[model samples]
Target: GMAEEEARMMRIDPEKLTQIILMGYTTKEARRGLRSAQGNIDQAVEFIIENRRLREECHREEEAREEEERIQRRYGLTENGQKINITYLQQLQSMGYPRRACVEALKQSNNRLEEASEMLLTNLDTLITASRVAKRDNEDDDDQETELMEDATHIPQLIALGAEFEEARALLEIYGNRLERAVEELLQKAQDSYETMHEHNDPSLFERARTAVEKRMAKKIRLAEQSAADQQRRT
Candidate 1:
């Protein structure tokens, strides 16, 4: 019910998603950000709750997207738009080339089995190198994906401390391995975001939160300076 309703609300403009990705947001973040920016918020509290749910759903949606991409890369669909011929791929693979290289050759040859087989035989080295580069990129992404799992360990703690799951994970990722820092930042965001979302309806409270954030940052700077000075003296 909610899935259909949300789909109706935001179909996710592919052009917007591409532009957002080019602007340096990850594909997942771009999708989530689009959902957030396009949501029609009736109330601040409701928006906060809804945003959390949307973010959680964004994770699942992104997973599905990743699966689709893998399928396209390996198997290729039957229709147009970069679809590889599975038969061509299989035949080429039977010739002892990698599935990755075979898929690339098939796509490069427009799914003509003879041409694809010829390319695989003639340009095997280049095809293998290109696939290696792509595999390397995917490996790098796998490392970053592992980092997301590492960040997840702190979610229960944050939730127990009364912060939302998705918000806590986002803050922890932004802060990177600093549980205390992420918690403080999450609290600040919760306060500031509600005020900002509500059209500054409570400017006084927002101002106080800003003041506290400034003080915290100053304290961190002072601590860093002291540590650096101590190191300099030791040196």
Candidate 2:
């Protein structure tokens, strides 16, 4: 009714006004656009269409961000959904696995703690028997095993260079265990990331990134505390 009233006042047809509203124009916005276009329905609709496109784009971006945050919380992923939980590492440690071994398993299993743990428990000595018995084998299995070993070996080296355990392993696996290449690639990525942030200079983006990292860190801290308590109880 308000749209109709505004349309009547502006000498625009009721049908045109309804069309404008359906195109995501508010009554006031429709009136303004129509008035600026000298009451041309086509011109007003063009304006509404462009404005609606921009609004939809922004809405989609916000929805995507919310979904990502939700997934991070649900799956215990790190800030950018690229890392596993520290809690998983702590849990495996509480189960008597070494930190290095736990890290290796997690890398091999794509961060699935249970799968990694199982892999750690299974004996690789059976590999000789399996190789003798098997008629056909996956060509990539050996390559994958080699890659995992490279990740395991280079993780410590990467940590020595100031990268965290998971971060180091991820970079090495990504760069195919060429240590210098991985380091150079990571350095370049960091530089590019910094330059992008500098160019945008968005405080809100920074805040959101900080909040996500803090959320992951806080969860890890809680896991550490819980693990300590459990160990004390056991002792």
Candidate 3:
């Protein structure tokens, strides 16, 4: 009688409550469902049925999307509007073309595997030469002289200040390793960049144009004077 009364409070028949419990629901869980349904057995059953149906639908949708992705990958159809054949990729790789380079060529050749391969082969020499040139450029970047200049206290200090070692060495060379002049040159460059970024025009466009011309003339005069002084010093 007590069990039946408890089931009545849940608004379900005792047999239905027993069946729900036997279907792996705890009594506490069944009680929660009754509360959610406002003690309506029919509503609670309907809610549980809808929930299960929605969950299954979501699961099926997710499985379908995953299967589509798997099929796409197997056929080498990229999601990025490019259709690359896996067999073509393997054939290119076998012929020593880099995978990334092959992909690029394939895209450029409109995904025609034979055309992509031919393009790569036809320009192989030019490509190799270009690649070598790029590599040499990188090596040149790395080969900045690390050796300390004869009069410099630190080579890395100049490098840290964004001066290539050779550039710093040349500055030091020209100034006979005077740290002050080298540092001044670097600071001047920074100042020039700051002035360029912050430079404001006069309210009058004529005034702005005049100021620019004057600055250019003054720069030329200064350069001529410096050149003369350098030549006299050399003599």
Candidate 4:
């Protein structure tokens, strides 16, 4: 509506009256300023306020961006710097230090990688020393218990009564050899039993009776050996 009125005024005999209203000045003020300035409403308005404001805003934004760039440069917190720091942290983690510990070590070392690694190694050494001390203390406790038990029991009496050292050593050696042989025989027997069990789901009654007879014969042989040994020891 204002623009239409201005256009109507411009279409009238004088175009100056249209410029005064659009330039936000009264007709008398427009006339006074018209001698020094042209009656150009657009240029006047731009010069008076709009252009300055736009230029100031643009300058402020540019300064703000420059200040941000300056801060990032000063602190070395740019993209490349972040990448380098991340790589450093990863290297610390790969070297067996926990991430949080690595970060703290880095800070304590003034962000020096070598110093941080040395600190971490020192911490590990401390932990290892503590663990060894604990293990030694545990071993000492066990030794004390064993000594106490030995002092409380009658070990000498047990050794004297039917406990021949040479015979016991010889028997243990023989038993060890026998155990190896027995294991091999048991493995073979187990394999054979598995095969036999799988091969024949049902067998004749005579076959079952024959297996029972063989088991009884082996048991009688063991009993005879044991009886002969007992009789020899008594004599």
Give the candidate number with the greatest TM-score: 1
How close to the true structure is residue 12 of candidate 3, measured as C-alpha lDDT?
A: 49
Query: What does the lDDT read for residue 49 in candidate 1?
Result: 51
How far does residue 218 in candidate 3 sit from its true spot (Å)? 99
Which pairs clash (backbone N, Cα, C closer than 3 Å) in model 3? Answer: none
Candidate 3 residues lying further than 4 Å off, grouped into runs, are 1-19, 22-32, 78-235
Per-residue lDDT of 17-67 in model 4, one digit per residue for the tens? 566557576555454344324555544444445445886999999997775
Off by over 4 Å in 2: 1-26, 35-38, 77-235
Clashing pairs in 4: none
* TM-score-superior candidate, 3 or 4: 3
Per-residue CA lDDT of model 1 for 113-209, tens digit only, reads 8887787667766766765576666643332222244454465567666676566677777888589998887678677778778875788777889
Please, what's the RMSD in Å of model 4?
Answer: 29.1
The true-versus-predicted C-alpha distance at residue 26 of model 3, in Å, is 6.7
Local accuracy by lDDT, each model:
0.66, 0.63, 0.62, 0.49
lDDT of 4 at 226: 97
Give residue 129's lDDT in candidate 4 (0 to 100): 43
TM-score winner between candidates 1 and 2: 1
Give the distance in Å from residue 197's predicted Cα in candidate 1 to where it truly belongs.
85
Ranking by TM-score: 1, 2, 3, 4
User: Which of candidates 1 and 3 is the stronger one according to lDDT?
Assistant: 1
lDDT by residue (tens digit), candidate 2, 1-235: 8898666656866777787778777997787678767678898877767777998999999997775554334333332345554667668645543444554456556778778778756732232233223313433322222225424545545555566666776787778878898888767766767767786775557888999999999999999999999999999
Candidate 3 lDDT by residue in tens digits, 1-235: 9998666675745666666667676676566666567666667666666767897999999997775455334334333577665567667645545444455456556678788778666654443344345435544333232333243333335666877656766777777778789888978877677767766742355577889999999999999999999999999
